[model samples]
Target: MKITVMTADEQFITLDVDPEESVENVKALLEVETRVSLQQQQLLFNGKEMRNAERLSSVGVRDNDLVMMVLHTSAPSSRAPTNDLSFHPDGSAINPGAFQQHVRRDSDMMAQLLQRDPALAQAILGSDLNGLQNLLRERHQQRLELRRQQEEEMALMYADPFDVESQKKIEAAIRQKGIDENWAAALEYNPEAFARVIMLYVDMEVNGVPLKAFVDSGAQSTIISKSCAERCGLLRLLDQRYKGIAHGVGQTEILGRIHVAPIKIGNIFYPCSFMVLDAPNMEFLFGLDMLRKHQCIIDLKENVLRVGGGEVSVPFLQEKDIPTHFLDESRYSKQGSLGPGSLPESSGAKEKNDNMPTGSRSSGTTLSDPTRGPEFEAKIAKLVDLGFGREAVIQALSLFNGNEEQAAGFLFGG
Candidate 1:
């Protein structure tokens, strides 16, 4: 297990050691890397001193946990050593010697940099300190040069537009400024479009098996996958008379409907029904029908699902805790067929072309490739008149499937 040991000087030393190892062994390892004697080392975890004989696990130390190390001097000194080094909060060392020492001890950071830049690794590993010092100086100068260039560009943006000498620069600056304003307006009006949507989910049990039910109020009926129903032994209660194809944004075949089952949410069990779908990707969906029937409240402010008219409250899963596979929309789209309201295929559609790419959707009347037709050229010209670049307008239109409003919104940073 890897654990971080932070010194009193705020320097972090990550150590990969076993949880069952004695605390004394950890101090001994720190002594070799930190140049501090084991006798001068005092390890503290969670504000409590750790005993030398005690194992790290017995004292509540886990993987990636932090342990504080304080150093003590055997004798008082009038002056500090020139070699003594400290670290800044951003992880930069005060001196090249400190950085070299840290890089040698941190295997994870070394392995990452080794993969990224071999020249950087060579400089750090070199015996001569001048190479490392020169490398750091070059990096510092590069950052300063970038900052100077940005400042000069900003000055040109604010320069007089009517002046003859700076006409070209002023025109370019004005175009960029218009794009910036459009982006800012879109962000202010619709911030939700830029936010990461955390789907609401509540913990519940079907019969005796635990399950996480997604709360989607837009759905007409509570639905469960056929595999989930079979796992819960509820397939016997399925009524095949209600089986049909559901049409909406997409279409899915409904296998059947379960009449009723006891669903345990929190401490109470409520009678709930489910429409079984043949989908294997999704486990369960808590739709509007069951939510309204149970008088459930989806409290956005508190971020909890209130079941049984506020009688039981269940917290929604956080972004980090949500299942990775559930976030993939492409998997669901592959299983669905075209709905009734879908647009017709383009007139240029090729019949049974073996050269066609797999999983590619049929393009409509508006051409995705600008070279395909004059209609796309006309549309691009109309959008470019609104002060956006010709290339940007073409890309936005293609991305949005030729929807003018949605394309404009995307170009404005939505």
Candidate 2:
């Protein structure tokens, strides 16, 4: 059989060998071909780590499979076999237990990094961080830009209160898609910005108590730290032991039980899966498998993850609505003066006011008002409630095409 190996350095090594070769033979061949020590490197097929003990059966090794080699550069691995350690027995002979101890130490470190950040570990195991970091950073930037585009798309998706005819035009456009007003509205987020993306946040629960997580989509798998698992009251149910080594990190033992909680994001709820990692640096990580189901809109260019069924507008600073110069002085200081930083008191006062707690802000508004039900008597009450500016309510309802439940999700993503 002919085997091709892809190194982390973007190099490829093709070897003609027997199909019965053990994975250890491939590693040794790779070490000889690439000058990377088998004990100091890990190999992967596709995206998963490949063990040296695996045999290259026809199903396991085939042509065109992406075989990657990751070289170990830093960090002491307790998993890899090393002969650096020795202990003198009472007879002054070298004890092999020292080598065992080294292997044990490396195993522990590899476990830790895997549990803490499997994706990062995957990168390290690939013997490449630069490529992975660049990829993630690019993804993040795209998310930010996506948010900006969403802001620009709001007028196009929703009928503006001030633009009645424009509103009708949008309704007409979506109506042509064979969609009802409600369904259209539910999916009416800016396609260029909020379409075809799934964004999620981590919600950890300890005995059913919710915990907030700032999710990083770049992460590969869920990693819950030991302390967090303890706090969440997770008792160790089993040991998911993995033995491999990554560069510049330690190993870990992942021990925790699965806990489910409602993850609410912009009118979306996901009951999720979690794994406990023993890293002190990590709180929790949400992986990619769960995100593929929902319709997610991520503005990678905007640095914001809009979870589901709503527009997440990324704020940008622009010059607009500046107060006209208050040439009237003592009588009219409210007219505003100076440039971005011309007035010291104005800036300080502005900062002080900004620092104060905001009363409350919801991501959305109610369809009518909560106090008013669907009854005729609630009509007047509804109108009264709409007085908080019925236009806003209309806009929010328009967001859901009138599905108040979803609209509430977008509006009150509290």
Candidate 3:
């Protein structure tokens, strides 16, 4: 992207930038030129928070695009940088343009590096921002760029373009998906892929106890279940405002103690990250942290999520077939992660009470009877083979309203 950086004083510094550079990077550039602390800057990319990890090209920033940067004060000194652009600590001049250009070159070179080493660039570029700024100031521009590029490219042989062409491919696919044109057009379209399944790893060590969990992609965030948090002594993180929690379908409850982890998924992880909400009743909802890096191929029928140019599969979804008899239509209508407004049909979901009779003794704990048929049995066999503990499969199937075909497609890839 070619961005014209109008400093707080209105001095414009136009520079061509890598489309994949983040808005945070743009802010860094402004800080460099304006001698403004990052905390003192307000950036609006279309009047919203300048997107992080959202590539400039995807956001419609062209070679001569003008970006606005303002300096904000009144924030505590702890927040704002010390009125300085020189991060060298030893006092040095930062060439923002050269620094950024070098970063762009490194990203370009990363395309050619070894596949197993892709995270290398992100580690260096995203981490130690202050250190990198110092290095850029001290080193010869060309030498720095040359060394990193060689280091990056020597590791690989191909790079994917993150540009309009890529987005056109997305738009074309949306058009072909048979979606309503108006709805599709109405979406200003998130730059790059907007929807994401988060990828994260847990890091918790308190009282000599290390409790870890891999961030589930389908899960919204790093969930420290209320039960788990209490037992683990991590409850201090949540201030008991009791804002409530959201779970699969629309179920909500006042809960506490959960944190989010920044992770890499699809392809890359982000920087200066945040934590996920802590809620006792909710199962968790993964957000942008996981989704941003991936170009996903969601095969509803196949129940597969393909990421990053289809080089590999994350995990296959276990499908369950729903049966017709016990299928309650309303159960499947539930949506969200909060409240009974849409709790998924699970945990022995009860059917319409009135349907049973004036006085009936319920058999209890039954979602469906197994005598339905061999075809149904076969679907159950598939789910069983998929390893959805029989109990879970039964619950998910009941919720899917006995659409065994849909459930199987949903739980286990067709």
Candidate 4:
């Protein structure tokens, strides 16, 4: 019977074979024709895989049927027979143990035997035992060389005081490694230690109540603790069905989201949305989505979170007013000029102070102030004319402290 065989690379070949022949016979012929070993040939018929022991007629294979063949390069196992051991070089019966010992001790005899049969040489080279030993030795040498180079480079990076960029790179790498190791160790030993470490927390207001929120750039969606949401009356704003599941470190929970929840950071307000989850003893988490939308910048080294970087200096809460709640007491002691008590409450509340001069207070009046209704409306209209959503423009205006220039900066920052 004649059949057509198609290869994975879209090559085709026509072959004539007996209908009663086993699939192994077809594989042997394919190996001779295509140089693909019988063990590496994967045959498929009618979209189903074919086994070597299966007979062509038993599998419903008919004349002119099409079969697909895929070739792989996996080495044969060590225990697999590579060559016939029935005859010796002197045409005598070969003993397996004596042959192995002779091949091990007599390199000249091994070479002469391999030279006589090229197939045996090819089989030995393609065996897993030879390949695995070479691969393992190469990997070990590469790793040792890599480790030595890293040690030398690190020594130079630390010894050379003038190489600032290298020093910075090394320090950043070490810091990231330390953070990963410490976080893993903490999770293993004291899972609750995460709550006490508040290096990324920022003071903000939900609705009108003061609250602390964590800035998590890695998170895809902003999250509000259920307790915090309840306290701020944000639970009442939940309009969407709580069908989504949130995955965390060691837990997964159903989450409810509140759209357009008013959040105030410093003196600016942002109409942000948050997924509400039942996180105990933890504050709100502002994710990358909200941070990117607001063009927020977190500068840990300077210890200041700045928004709207250019000419129009937006209203910002003094660093002193922001609290440091890190578990590491050393950070508390290292708090330089930006301590909580450094700025007077009156100075920090300059825009809201009732005792300020009339001219000064009028100049500081923002869109958030109820007295600037007409001006706020005009600013919103102008921003909407610039192709921004009314709600988004209003939020941006509040986030920029009512400064039209700063609001425009925020919108176009991306």
Candidate 5:
């Protein structure tokens, strides 16, 4: 018989199972299919919780029946309020029906109260109204004290900027911090600074297998997830003594380097080296090392990744077309830029340059030009908001000599 399983995220999967199979056995099958552990799965059938020892037939499960599975970090609480009550504080008998109705009216509040006081959970289930009332009062008092302490801490942190002692303490704390402190400070003071650039991704092939790759200019070296390498059968054990560490925002990890790894994008095939990291969340990253070597240009305006100076360009997959697992939706926007500088201007810019005398333009071009100043940052941010990565947008603008229309065209493949 086939059973349809639905997850909390609304993902559905169909499984064939024996009539005598237990709920735990079904969970084992789900673990293999979904990569979710059995312990985290809470299976429900017909609005009733399914026990590990319960048989499918015993639970009256039919073919193609839908079973709901909720994933949680911990087991769900089984406590529930009953239609019974205890004596009140004044030695008066509480009305069982009224107390039960109150608990039923705000089930979420009662659940929170039970979570804060596990000892009171049994009292609630057993209808010990007086015990539950006392427990709730104590929990409320604890929350009040916690909130007061948090408020005091916030007040001290935001004390008068002109207060020398407080400012000195703040400076000292910042000085003692690591790289994450700077990121936090930037997030707090200059959110737009980081928001100007967004992550870019493209579809590429590795050993004839389609793979999604993140385009990151800031990464010193190309990196591939160990899982991807292994899945592609490209992972070869390196010398044990050649271990190295890779540092990124807020974290660092040891990596195993692989050389001469071939990656194919469109018609071009490039043999590059990559540092293999155990990055499960991100499978592939095409870093500066590969981009520079290929003279690759990511045209956000054209919506393509050009190789060999536009000799060959592959259009990127639309956000919706890309696999849900491959992209981090939270970090990207859906809006796209259509205005000037949002298209490619390769032809126009080249024509203008050809008309000008050689060496007429300044020889000095700084790496920071595309990303510098409020106007440039604003343009990049706007393009990013339109669903393009900041680096790709900046690169397109630079390629077109800051022509917004050309960059935008380039991104949209216009």
Candidate 6:
């Protein structure tokens, strides 16, 4: 079979040989044909370094196929080469263009060599073949040494910790880890410790009455204050059968639930159901149920609440625009302890105990009703001093007929 061999200098050598011929035999033939020594010739077929024992047919070589030849630096031959392009006689300058094309053919190797040894660029440009070859050899050896050191380090990493050599590395690694952890901890700041974030609220209208709706995904059911419901004309729609206690960070009396109400958000009215709680501070809460039913997405990235699967986006109220009452942490801090009295009475909504029997009164009513004896006043003061809200203490006392133990139990959710 006839095959062509392309030299690094782009010279072609056509040879007729057997398909079963070994790669070493082919190199010997190339040496005789090109006058280059066999030891200096490196054979590559299809970009793979061919083994000496690999046959032409076994290496996937066929008729008319091309193999590449790379010549490396070696001792001078006894007989001077006549037509070899890589070698020059008596310090003759190599062809700069041919040398550049040869190096550029393997872009990765050329880049690595240039990065490791910047002077390689000058050598290539100067057409100094011997100098370029020496620089490449030095860089290659340095790379091999670096690889050997890395392999040794990796081996040591898994070696016995009790070994004398490994002890220093282990100690150094532990010290480095501690230093890194300390640095990270020093740079980390907890926002809750130094600052408070404003609650998320959006402008919404319920039954023609405008109100701020607190967007709380953490709330399982949507809720609205009884006063807000009455203001929005939704009080008439409340189903008293759903009357129960609403439990969260604190427990509150749920008067009833509004079965259905239209809440207008950004010109779009969405049907929303609300559990009517006697809460005084927050007028409305947009909870998870409505969020999921409406396909709402709380996009913190854009700082907006996306409704109807992103069809509409409503921006939350800014800090300056948000009501100061909602931003007061101290009011909420005494939540469960204060009971109904914990709620502000600025609005005209009746106290939570308004529905209770005439004989019982909430703390708010007890405080104003001078007819109550001094003994009742002392009991209320005692419970209030114990961190229980005055209204809650009075209600508890009423439920237990003024028995402090039972009332304390009731106050603690017993």
Best by lDDT: 1
TM-score of 5: 0.34
Best by TM-score: 1
Give TM per candidate: 0.42, 0.23, 0.22, 0.30, 0.34, 0.38
lDDT of 5 at 366: 20
Q: In candidate 4, residue 210 scores what lDDT?
A: 85
Instruction: For candidate 6, write residues 107-162 as lDDT tens digits.
Output: 54355446644687667656666776565556446544655765555666898978
| TM-score preference between candidates 4 and 6, better one | 6
Could you give candidate 3's per-residue lDDT for residues 1-414 as a string of tens digits? 467766677655555567777666666555544456556777655656566467676777777777777767764554323622234433243444443344345443344222323443443446555655555444335434545654444333233445666556555545645554543553356312222222232332322344333333333223344554555455566534333333333334434323433333334442212222333333232333343444545444665455555654444322122122112322333332321112212322222323334464223233332225676566667678756766555544544434454454445431
Root-mean-square deviation of every model:
19.0, 30.1, 25.4, 26.0, 22.8, 23.6
Model 5, 360: alpha-carbon shift in Å?
42
Clash pairs, candidate 4, are none
Candidate 2 stretches with Cα past 4 Å from truth are 1-212, 236-248, 256-261, 266-268, 301-303, 309-414
Error of 4 at 111 (Å): 74
- Across residues 6-26, which tens digit of lDDT does each residue of candidate 2 receive? 677876566665676667667
RMSD of 2: 30.1
lDDT of each: 0.67, 0.44, 0.44, 0.56, 0.60, 0.66
Ranking by TM-score: 1, 6, 5, 4, 2, 3
Error of 4 at 89 (Å): 69
Candidate 1, residue 193: how far the Cα is off, in Å: 4.1
Q: Total clashing residue pairs per candidate?
A: 0, 35, 38, 0, 32, 1
Cα error of candidate 1 at position 290, Å: 0.7
lDDT of 6 at 58: 98
Worst ten in a row by lDDT for model 2: 342-351
lDDT of 4 by residue, 43-146 (tens): 89988888878899999899999999987567563332434223333322233443244233434434543654454333334544444334434534554465
